[model samples]
Target chain A: MKQTQALNLQQKTIKALGVNTSDAKVSLSYLSVAFLTLLIGGILGLVQGLERAGLMELPPWINYYQVLTAHGILLLLVFSTTFTIGYQYANLSHALGGLLPKVRKFAWTGFILMVIGVVLAVTMVVLNEASVLYTFYPPLAAHPVFYIGLVFVVLGIFACCIGVFINYRHWRKNHPGQTTPLLAFFAMGVFVLWFFASIGVTVEVLTLIPWSMGIVETTNVMVGRTLFWWFGHSLVNIWYLVATSAWYVIVPKIIGGRHFNEKLIRLVVILLVILNIPGGFHHQIIDPGISESIKFLHVFMSLSIAVPSLMTAFAMFAVLERAGRRKGGKGLLGWIGKLPWGDVRFLAPMIAMIAFIPGGAGGIVNTSNQMNQVIHNTLWVVGHFHVTVGMSVVMTFFGICYWLIPYLAKRKLTPQMNRLGVIQTIIWTVGMILMAGSQHLAGLLGDPRRTSYTTYGDHPTALSWVPYEYVMGIGATLLLLGVIIQVYAVINMMFFAPKGKTAFPVSEPEDGAPSAPMWTERWGLWVVLLLMVVAMAYVVPIVDMIVNAPPGSPPIRTW
Target chain B: MKQFLYGLVLYLFLLLPPVAALLESIMIIHMHMQMPLLILSGFLMARLIQLKFPDFFRKWNSNGVPGIMLFSIILVYWMIPRTMDEALTIEASELFKFISLPFLAGVPLRDSWKKISSAGKNSVFIIFIILFSLMGWLYIAADEQICNNYLRVDQITLGWGYVTMAVCMAIYVIQLIFGDHSEYK
Candidate 1:
C-alpha cells in the first residue's frame, strides 16, 4: 500500500487523490444513462425521419408533435446533460488529482435525480399528458406532473453543478495559488455558464407555476417568453462551451499536438462565462416590446461571443499544423491529411468542427436583425442548431465515449469496435451533410420548421418543403443507423470486450509562456463584469417591459 | 412519544394547504406551495416514525437507499400533473395527497436521506433537478389545459415556476457543496 501510494504521487496528482475507482463508476453511470437516452432518442429520430419522408405513417396515439418532443428532450436534454456530467466527472477527477469524497456523493445524487426526472417527464410526453414541445412556451399547458418532473431534472443537474463547485473548492485549497488544470478550467466555465444562464428559465418558471396553478388569471406572454429565451440562448452556449472544451483540450492531444497557450485558453473560457449570458438578447432581436436600440446592442454582444470561437479555430489549427509538421508532413494544408483520420477520436471532432463553419456562419446571419427576418423560425434555424449542437456537441461526445467507455470499463477497444467507430463518424458526417444541408436549403426557401410538410393537406406553399423533407428523412435515417452502431460498439466495449486499461491522453502546453495573467483567475472581477454585461443587455428592456407592459393574456389551448 | 408529536406536526403542516383551500384555489399555490409542503411534512414524519419504531425504520431504511427510493417513488407519484389536478377536483385525491405527502413520501425520505450514501444524495439531487426542468417544459410548452381549474396559458406559466425553483435549488446545491468543503477545512 505504501509503495502504491508513493507511485501514485509520482505519477499524477489525480491518481494521488485516490478517487479514480469511484470516479470511474460515477462517470460510467452517467455515460450509461446518456447512452440509454441516445438509443431511445435515436430510434425516435428514425421514426420521425421516416414520417417526414411520408414512408411510414405514425399512429394517432403517437403524433408528430409527440415524437418531436421526445426526440428533442431525450437527445438534447437527457443525452447531452447526462453525457456532459459524466464527462466532466471523469475528466475533472483525473485533471484535478481526484475529487473530494463528498463531491462525488453529490454527483451520484444529481444523477439519480436526473434519471427520475427524465422518466417522469418522458412518461407524460408518451402518455400524451404533456404534448408540449421541448421549448414549453407559455399559453400551452401540459400535466402539472410534467412540470414537476422537469423541475427535478433541473435540480438534479443543479446538484451535479454543486458537486463540481465543491470539488473545485477542495482542489483550490489543496493547491493554493496554483493554476487549475486546463480541462477543469473548461468544466468550470460550463458550470458557471449553466448556473448563470439558468436564471432565465428560473424566472420564466417561477412565473409559470403561479399562472398554471391559476394563482393568476392571466400570464404576461412577453415576460415569460423573454425569460425563456434568456435561458434558452445561454443553454446553447453551455453546450458550445462543452464542445469548445474538447476542441481546446482533447483535440490537440488526440492529434498528437500540444495544448494551446493555457493562459489564453483560460481567458477565453472566462470571457465565455461573462459574455455567454447576455447574448440571449440575440434570440429576442425580433420580439416586440423590446426597443430596436436594445435589440441592436444585443446583436453586437451576440457577435462578440463569436470572437473566442474564432480564436479557438486559429489556435486549434495551429496546434494541428504544428503536430503534423513534427510528424514530417510537407506543406500548409497537407498536414490535415497527415493527422490520424482513421482514429474515431480525431475524425469525429474534426468533422464536427468542419460542420461548425457553416453553423457559426448561420449564427452570424441569425444575429443580424434584418437578416433574421429572412430565416427566423425557418428550416434554416433548425439546420443551424443541428449543425452546431447536434453535429458539433453530440459528435464530440460520441468520440469521447469511444475512448471513455473503454477507460471506465477497464476494457480494451476491440478492432471491430474501432472499425465501427470510424464508420459511425463517416456515416454521421455524410448523414449530416444530406440532412442539415437540405434543411438549410429548405430554410432559405422559406420552408417552415416543425411541420409535417406532407400532411399539409392543400397548402400550396407545402410543395416547396416536400423535397427537402424527403432528403432530410433519408439523412436522418442514415444518421440514426449510425447511432445504433455507435451505441452497440460502446455497449460491446464496456461489457463484452476483453479487459485492459487505456491511456488518457493529456497533452502539455506548446506555448512556453511564463505565467498566466493574475486577472484570469480573479473570478470575482469576471463575475461582476458578467453581471454588468447582463444588466446592460437586459436592464433597459426588462424595465421597459415592467413599466409599459400590456395587459396579461389569458391562457389559450390550441390543441 | 416525542417522535409521534413530530409526526403529528408534519401531518398538520401538510393538511394546512388543503384545509385552507390553498391547494385547490390556485395552480401555482397548489404545486409550489402545497406539494413542497407535503414533501417537507412527509420528511419530518419519517423521522418521527423512525424514532417511534426504530426497528422498523432500521430494517427498512438503515442503508437509506431503499427508503429514499420509496420516498422518490411516492414523490414522483404526487408530482404528476394529473395527480395534482385530481387532488383539486376530487375530494378523495386531496385526502390521498395529504396522506401520501407526509406519511408515504415525507417520512420515508427523512429516514432514507440520512442513511443514503453520498452517491445516493447526488442521484437524488439530479432527479429533482431534471424533474423541475421537465415540469418547466411541460407548463411552458403545453397548448392545452392540463388542469381543469387553470387556463392553458396558466399551466404554461406554472411550468416556469418549476423551472425557477429548479434553478434556485441548483444554485443552492452549489452553495451547499462549496459551503461544506470550506467548513470542513
Candidate 2:
C-alpha cells in the first residue's frame, strides 16, 4: 500500500491548476454506456459468427441474430454516435473556456434518452418479440415499440447535435481570434451537417410515428421513402466525418507534425456535408416507382464524392511522410520504419485504413445501380461496413479515447491501459478481418443478412453457409474477450488507479502555439440549422414523387 | 414505323421494373401507413434494401455531414410517400415512366459521395468512377437492354447497379495500386 502511494504520488501534479471543463463527467458517462454497448456488440458478433456456421449447440451464443441486431443498433447507432460525440464535446469544452448550458443540458438529456431507447429496443428484440435489427425497412416490421424506441433514439441524436452546436458556439465566443481546432471544426461541421441531416429523418419519424401507429389511413409511401433515404444515406456520411476528423487530428499528432493544408480539410468537410444530401436516390436503384434519370444522377454524384477522400488521403500522408523524414528516418520508405508501431494512436488507425480495401469493394458493389443483383442484402455487404466503419472509425475512436483519456483526466493512465490498447487493437484487427471475411463468404453462400434462425443442430442444408459462419463465430469470440479486457482496464483506472489521480483538476493544453477556443458559437448553430432547411428543401421533391406517382399508370415507359 | 416499334419494345422493358420494384416499395411504404400494407411492403422493401440499396448507380454519403443527411433521408423518405407528391407532376411521372432515364445524377450510387469524402483516401478513386459511369451510359445508349431489365428493377437496370459497382471497385483497385499514403511510395 505504501509503495502504491509512492507510485501514485509520482503521477499527481498539484501545483498546476487543471483545465475547467465538463469533459470528465460527460465523457465518462458516455464511455460507460458505449463500453457496455461495445461488449454487447462483441458478444452478439460472436453469436452471429457462430450461428452463421450453424454452430449453436457448440456455443449458446450461436443462433443470435436478435442479439446481433441488438448489438449493431446499439454499437453503430447508440454507442458510436454518442461516445464519439461525447469525446468531441469534452474536447471542445476544454478548448473553449467553459460549457454552454443549452448544449450541456441537451447533451445529457440525449445520453439518458439514448440509454432508455437502447433498453427498449434491445429488450423487445431480445424477447424475440421484435427482431427487425438496426434497419426498420418496413415490410419486415418489428413491434411498434421498436419503431418508437428508435424514434426516441433519434431524438437523443438530435439532442447531441444541440450539444455540438453549443460547443461550437462556446469555441467561437471564448476564442474570437483563433481558428477552430481542426478536430473541433470537423466535429462542428459534421454536427451541423447532422442537425440538417437529421431534419429529414425527424420529418419522417414525426410523419412515420403517427402513420406507423395507424393514425393515417392513406399515408403517402413516396414521402416516407424520400425522407427515409435522405436521412439514411447521410447517416453513413456522419460516420465518415467522424473517421476523417479522427484521421486529421489524431493521425497527424501521432506522426509529430501539425496539419498543413487545414483549409482543404475544412473544405472537404463542407463539400462533403452539402454534396451528401443531393445524392441519396442511390437506394432506389432497383425500385421501379422512381425515375431512372434520378438514379443516374445519384450514381454520378455517388462516384463524384470520392475526390475529397482521395485528396485527404494524399494530403495527410504527405504530412506523415514529412514527419517521418524529419524524425531521421532514412531512405524514401525508411520513414515508415521510424513510425511508432506500439503506440495505439499510430498503430490502430493504420490498421483501420488498411482494412478499407474490402470495405471500398463492398461499398462499390452495394451502391452500383446494376451490380446489386450479384450481392444485395448479402453477408458481403455487412462485412464491407464492418471494415470501413467499424474498424476504421470505431477502432480509431477507441485509439483516440485511449490517447486522450489521460490528458482529459490530468493523470497518466495505468500502464496496463497501454497493454490493453495493444491487446484490444490486435483483437479488433484480427476479429474484424475474420468476421468480415466470413460474412462476405456467407453472403456468397446465400446466407441471409438479418435472419433470426440460422442455427440448427442436425441439419446442414438448412444452414447452407455453416462452414463460413464458424469463422465469424470465432471472430466474435475474440472481440468479446478483447472488449472484456478493455472494460476491466477502464474499471481499474476509474476505481483503483491509486488515490489522488481521480480528483486531479483538469488543465488546458500547454502546447503554447497560441491556444484558442475550439469552435465558434454562431457558426455551428447557423450552419447546422441552415442545412436543416436545405435538407427539407432537398427531400420534399423526392417524397412528392413517391406519394403522387400516378398509380397503375405503368410509369409511362417510352424507352 | 420501325422507330416506333423499337421505342415500344424498350418502353415495355422499362415498364416491368417500375411495376415490380415500385409495387414492392409501395407495399413497404403503405404498410408503415398501417398494418395491412406493412405485411406486404415490409417483406418487399427489406428485399429491396438488401437486394437494391447498394446499387452502383445509387448515391452514397458514408462521410460526415453528407452521410448523416443521406442516412436520415432514407428513414424519413420511407415514412411518407406523400412528401414526394409535391415534387412530381403527373406528366413528369409519366415522362419518368415513359423514358428510362437515370435518376439523381444518373447513377444509383450517389451515396458514394459520403463514403468517398468520409474515407478520406477514396478521393483519387473517384476519377475512375466517373469514367465508368460515362462508359455505362454510352453502352446503354448504344444497345444492350437485354439483361438490363432482368436486372431491371422497377424502372432501373439491375445490370446498371452491377456495372456501377464494378466501376467503384475499379477505382478502389487503382487507388490501392497508386494511392497509398505510405512512405513506401
Candidate 3:
C-alpha cells in the first residue's frame, strides 16, 4: 500500500495547501519569473547608484530619469507586487483552508493580463514618451499606455483577488459559525484593502491617461496627488499588514512548541485591519491644500497602527520568556540566547522582529508633517521607506519563502546556506541600514529621489553632497552584493536543496474554537471596525482638500 | 502566457546593464550621443563585472589585498615617479568625478564580517536601521542632526537623507561585525 493514501479534496485543502509544490513543471515556472524580475530590478538599482555618482554616462534612452522611472515602476509595481499576489494565489488560498476553483483557468488569465500590462508599460517608458516618477502625480504625466498597462495589472490582481475571496468565503460558509482563521481573515482584509486602495489611483489614471496621450486637455495636479496617495500610503501599509500576519503565527509556532496568547493575537489582527487605512494622508503632509488638522489626524492614526505591533512584541516576548525559562536561560536577555539557535524558522522571525525596530522608526518620521519637509523627497525618505518596506515586509516574504520552498516544493535551500534565515536577515538588516542612512543624508542635503544625475550645474555650495552620493553608492554596492548572493541561494534551492515529502494529516484547528479565548472572538471585530471609522474621519478631510482645491494654486517652491 | 511574462522580466533584467554601453555604442553609429552615457557605461561595466563574478574577474575583482601585495613593488617604483607630479593639484573630472574623490569602503581592510559571523546579514542591518534613523531624532533633540529639526526642521535636505541611510546601514553592517548575535554559532 502507498505510505499515505491521497486524501479527498476537503482534507487536501488544509494539509496539502501547496497547489503545485511537488510538480517541477509548476514550481520552476513561478520561480523563473520571480527570479528574473528580482535580478532585473537589482541591476537597475546599481545603475541608479552609478548615475547618482556620475561614474558613467550614456544615451538619453538610458538617462537617469528614464532608468529611474522604469526601475521604480518595474520593481514595485511589476516585480514585488506580482510575486506577492502570485504566491498568495498558488499557496495562500489552500494554506488558508480554501479551494481554488478552476485553478488552471484562473492562473492562465492572471498570467496573461500581467505580461501584457508589463510589456506595454516598458515599451512606453523606453520610448521617452512617459517618464513620470512611478507616482500618478500630475501635471507630470506618462504616455497613455502607462495608464493602460497599469489598468491591466490591476485587473490581474482583481482576478486573483476575486478567486481568493470566493475560496475564503466558501471555506467560511461550509465551516459555518466558526470565527474566520486569522490568516484567512488577513488574506481577506488584504483583498478588500487592495480593492479599496486601487480606487483612488484608478480614478487618477483614468483621468490622466487620456491627457498624457493628448486625448484630453489639462487635469488638476492637486487632485491627482491626493488620489494617488489615497492609493500609495495604504498600498505600502497593506504590505506591512500582510507580512505581519505571518509573523504573529509563525513566531509563536517557531518558539512556543505551542501557540501563544490567542486573545492577544486576535487583538493584533483586528487592530491592524482597522489601524492601516487612515494613514495614507501622511504622504500629503507638505502638499498644498490638504488641511493641517487632517494631516495631524493621519499621523495619529499611523502611530495607532503601532499599538498592534507593540502588543504583538510584548506577547512575542512573553512567549520567548517562557521558552527561555524552560531552557534555564537567565541573564539580561538570556532568554533569546537559549532558544534554538540553528533552526531557520525560529531565527528568521527573530531577525524580522529585530529589524522591525528600525522599520518602525522610519514609519514614525515619515508620517510627521513638519519633520517630513526636512527629509522629504531626499534619499532619507527613500531610505526610510525601503528599510521599513524593504527589510520589515520584504524580509518576511523572504523568510516565508525560505521556509515554504521546502514545504511546498519539497526542496531545501542549501549548501546549507547555514542558518539561512538568520544570516540573510542580518545581512539584509545591515544593508537596509547602510543604504537608508546614506540615502537619508543625501536626501537631507537636497539630493532628489529618482534623479539619475546629481552632478549638475551651479550647486557648488552643495559640494559636500557629491562625496555623500558616492558614500551611498558604496552602500548600495554592499546591499546589492547581499542580494546577488541571496538570488544564487534561491536558485540553488530550486535545483539542489534537500527535499521533504512527508505530509502532516489534516487536523482540527491549532486551537479548537472553544479553547480560543473569549475576548479574542468578541472584541477584535468591534475594535477594528471602530478604529477604521475614526481613522477615515481624519483621512476624509485631507482628501476633501485635494478634491476641492481650485484648479492650479501652484506648488510652493523651496526657495 | 507564462512565457510572455518570463520574457519581459528576463529581457528587462538583461537589458539594463547594457543600456549605458548600448547608449555609448549609439554614438559610434550616430556620431553624437550624450556625455553622461559614456560615464554611465563605465560604472555599469564595473557593476556588471562585479556582480557577474565577484571572485573570478581579474581586472576588476582582483583580490585588492593580495594583488596589492604582489604589485606593490611595480606600482611604487614605476608608477610613483611617473604619476607623482600629477597626483597633487589635480582637479576632479566632471564626468568621472566620483573617481577624483576618495572612495570610502573604509580602508577595504577586509573582514567586515568575522569568520564566525557576518555583520552584513539582513537581520542585524535591520536593528541598526532603526537606530540610524533615530540618529536624526537624536540629532534633532540635541538641536543639530538633532536641534532645529524634528517637525520644526526646514527644507528637503541631502544631509539628513543620505547620512541617515548611510549611518543606518553602516551601523547594521558594523554591528554584524562587532555584535555576536551570531545565529550560526
Candidate 4:
C-alpha cells in the first residue's frame, strides 16, 4: 500500500501543476524568444560599443540612435520580461502544484501578441522610422506602429500576470491554512507590483498612439516625459523584484542554506509592493513645475523604499552565513569559503549582489534632491542603472536560466555547459566592472549619456571623456562575448542536450517552518497600502500641473 | 455599450480646443476636469474592453492592480502643471487628454476598484492626503505664478484646498487607526 501511494505521488509530480506538456512548451517558447532576442540585442550592443570606440565605419542604414534604441528595447524590455515571465511561470506552477484554468491560453496568447508586437516595433525601428531611443521621449516621435506594438506587448504581459494571479487564487483554495509557498509568494509580489507600476507606461503608450498617428496634432512633452519616468522607475523595481525573488527562494537552497526567515522575507516583499511605486518621483527631481517640497518628500519616500533592499541585503547575507557555517566551517567569516563557488547558479547571483552594493548606493545619490542635480543626465546615471539593472537583474536572470533551461527541456546540464556557464558569469561580471566603472568616472567629468563619442570639434575639457569611452567600449565587447556564450549555452541545453529531470531546488527553513502570522499572506492590505502610497506621490503634483496650463509643444522629429 | 460610447463621446467633447481651453482657463475645473476625466475615460474603455475580453480582464485585473495603477498614472499626469499648460494651449495635447482619461483611467478603474480590498481603498486615501498636503504647501508658498494661465491668488486658493483636504484625510486616517479594534485569536 505504501509503495502504491509513492507511485501515485510520483505520477502527480510528473504532471507537475496539472497543466501537462503544453505548459513546458509555452515556457520553452518564451525562453527561446528571450534568447533569440538576446542574440540580436547583444550584437547591437557590440556594434554600439565599437562605434563609440570609432573602431568601425557605420553602415548607411544603421544609425547610432536606431541601434541604441533596438538594443535597449530588445535586451532591457524584451529579453528581461520574457525570460522572467517564463521562468516565474514554470516555478510558480510547480510550486503551486499545477496550472490553473486559462493559464495555458493566457501564456500562449501573451507569447503570440508579444511576438507580433516585437515584429512590428523592431521592424519600424530597424527601418529608422522610430529612432526616439528606448526611453522614447517625445517631441521625438516614433512611428505610430512603435507605440501600438508596445501597447500589445504591455497587454501581453497583462495577460500573463492574470494567469499568475489565477494560479495563486487556485493554490490558496486548494491549500487552506498552509503557508503560501515562498516562490509563488515572490512571483505574486512581483506581478502585483508590476501591475500597478506599468500604468505609467500604459498611459505614455496610449497618449503616444494618437500623437504619433496624427490623431492628436501636438503632444505635451512634459506630461509624456513625466509619464515615462513614472513607468520607467517602476520598471526598474520590477526587475529588482524579479532578481530578488530568485535570491529569496532559489539562492538559499542552491547554497545549502535553510530558508531565511520566511515571514521576514514575505514582509520584505510586501514592503516592496507598497513602497516601490511612488519612488519614481525621485527621477523627476530635476524636472520643472514639481515643487521643492514635493521633490523633497519624494526624496524621503525614495529613501524609504531602500529599506526593503537593505532588508534583503541583510536577509541574503544572513542566509549565506547560516548555510556556510552549518557545513562545519568555523568563525564569523570562515563560512564564506564553504559556499558552492563552483556552481554558476550561486556564483552568478552572488556576483549580482556584489554589484548591487555600489549600484544601490549610487541610487541613493541619484534620488538625493540636491545631489541629483550633479548627475541628472550624466553618464554617471547611466552607470548607476547599468550596475543596478544591467549587472544585478540581468546577471540574476542569467543565473536562473542556467538550471532553468535544462529543467524545462527535461535534460541534465552537461559538465561542459556548466563550465561554460561559470565562465560566462565571470566574463560578464568583469566586463560590467570595466564598463560601469568607466561610465561613472566619465560622468563625473560632465560627460552626458546617450551621445556617440566623437573627438572632433569639442572643447579641450571634453577630450577627457574619450579614454573612459574607450574603456567602456572594451567592456561592452567583453559583455557581448558573455552574451554570445550565454545564448549559445542555453540553445544547446534546450535542443542538443540529453534528456533527464533536474531538481527544482527550494530550501527549507533552518528551524523548520516558524509559525508565520496569516497576515503575512494578506495581499489585500499590501495592495491597498501600495495604491495609497502611489496616489500620494503622484496625485496632487499632477493636479497642480493641470490647474495651471503652459503652452504645449508639438511633436518634432530630429531624424 | 451605451455607457462606453457615451463615455467616449464625452471624452471627445472635452478634447475640443475651445471647450478644453475654457475649462482649463479656470483653476479648479482645469485640474479637476482634465485630470479626473483622463481616468474616467480610461475606466470606461477598460469596462468596454472587459465586455469583449472578459477572460483577459478577469485573469489579469481581477485583483485591481492594473486598473488602479493605470488610473493613478492618468490622474498624476494631468496634475503636472506642464501637462495642464500643454492641454490648454495645444490642440493635440487637449485631444490626448480627452481620449486617455476616460478610456485608460476611467474605464479600467471602475471595474478594478470594485473588487479591491478596503485596505486598498484606505491606502488610496493616504496617498491623497500626502499628495494634497504637499501640493497645498507648494501652492501656498509660491510667490509667483506657477502656471502661466492661473492667477497667483488662484494658486493660493488651490493650496488652501489641498491643505484642507489633507487635514480631513489625516483625521480619517487617525480615526481608522483608533477605531479598528479587531483581536487576533
Best candidate, lDDT-wise? 4
Candidate 3 docking band: incorrect
Q: How accurate locally is residue A327 in candidate 4, as Cα lDDT from 0 to 100?
A: 95
Quote model 4's iRMS. Answer: 6.3
> Which portions of model 3 miss their true places by more than 4 Å?
A1-9, A12-32, A96-98, A419-426, A455-461, A502-514, A517-548, A552-559, B1-185
lDDT of 1 by residue, A1-559 (tens): 5644653573374444333777889999998888888999999988987887677899877788889889999987888888898998888877876666788899988988888888998999998877778888777876767777787788887888888887776666556556778888888888877877777776676666667667777877777777777778888888888988888888888888898788778888998898887777777777888777668778999999889989888888888889888888897688777899988888898888887888899999999999999998888988899899989888988888777788888788877787889999889888988998999998898887776536467576777678888899889988988888888988898899998877676778866666555446555455556765665566546645754678887655565
> Scored by CA lDDT, what does every candidate get?
0.78, 0.59, 0.57, 0.81
Q: Model 2 fnat?
A: 0.00
lDDT of 2 at A454: 49
C-alpha RMSD over true interface residues, each candidate: 8.5, 12.8, 15.7, 6.3
The C-alpha RMSD in Å for every predicted model, in order, reads 18.7, 17.7, 27.5, 14.6
TM-score of chain A of each: 0.95, 0.84, 0.86, 0.96
Q: Is the docking of candidate 2 incorrect, acceptable, medium or high quality?
A: incorrect
Cα lDDT tens digits, model 3, B1-185, are 34334433443442354643343232111111222222233323334434555555345424354332222232222122123222222333212222311111211212122211332345435544564355434433443321121122221121243233545356445534543332212
Task: After superposing candidate 2 on the true structure, give the runs of residues whose Cα lies further than 4 Å from its correct spot.
Answer: A1-16, A57-65, A173-177, A218-222, A278-280, A452-464, A498-544, A549-559, B1-185
Better of 2 and 3 by lDDT: 2
**Tens-place lDDT digits, model 2, residues A1-559:** 5633542343242223343445467777787787777777766666665555656633453235566667778777777777777667765664454456677788889888887877887777876656555655443445657767777888888888878766665444444355766666777777767776777777765655554456543445565566777777777777777777767766767766566565566667777776676456666677766566556656776665677767777876776777788789889799987777777766887777666556666777777887866667777777777788878777777776665555555556656677778888998788887888888878777666766444556567546676677777788777778778767765665555643332222222223534333222234224443443343234324433643555421111110
lDDT of 2 at A4: 37
- Span of ten consecutive residues with least summed lDDT in model 3 chain A: A502-511
List model 3 lDDT by residue over A271-328, tens digit each.
6666666667677778776656557766787788888888877866776777676788
State how far residue A236 of model 4 sits from its true place (Å): 1.1
